[model samples]
Target: MENLSLGLMLMAVGMITVFSILLIVIYLSKLLIAIVNKVAPEEVAVKKATATASAPTVIDPNTMAAITGAVNIVTGGKGKVMKVEKI
Candidate 1:
């Protein structure tokens, strides 16, 4: 009976010790992150100037016809090419 009680006590102690160490590690890591962030803050990203819209692209008749034909074939004459844009 004494041996069983000692075993239970040892198990409880080990579990408590491990739990305390894990909690300490987690809190310490959080503190370190906070300190580092305060010391060297992240830089704000610069916004890029957007490209202006140019003149409408002109599609040649042959290329337009080919695109139209492909669309018609894929959609069984139900689809229409409304606008074509170059990459």
Candidate 2:
């Protein structure tokens, strides 16, 4: 009876140790990712909404065709994309 109890105790301790190590590794990885994101924040170009509203949009012939085809397929050939513009 004592031997069986000792074996179960050791098994529980081993599992707890493994779980603790996994948690520590996960914490360290998250900390590293946070530090990296802070150091290298993404660059977003913000334009004036009023300026965007008045700009002349131009569509490439190739892109327009591809977009039309994709849209037609996605809409089950029921509709099409009339235009695609590069801003």
Q: Score candidate 1 by TM-score against the native.
A: 0.45
RMSD of 2: 6.7
What's model 2's overall lDDT?
Answer: 0.77
lDDT of each: 0.81, 0.77
TM-score of 2: 0.43
Model 2 misplaced stretches (Cα beyond 4 Å): 1-6, 43-65, 69-81, 84-87
Residue 28 shift from truth in candidate 1, angstroms: 0.7
What are the per-residue Cα lDDT tens digits for candidate 2 across 1-87? 999999999999999999999999999999988887788654322345435653776555686788888888899999966555555
TM-score, every prediction? 0.45, 0.43
After TM-score superposition, the amount by which residue 63's alpha carbon in candidate 1 deviates from its true location, in angstroms, is 40
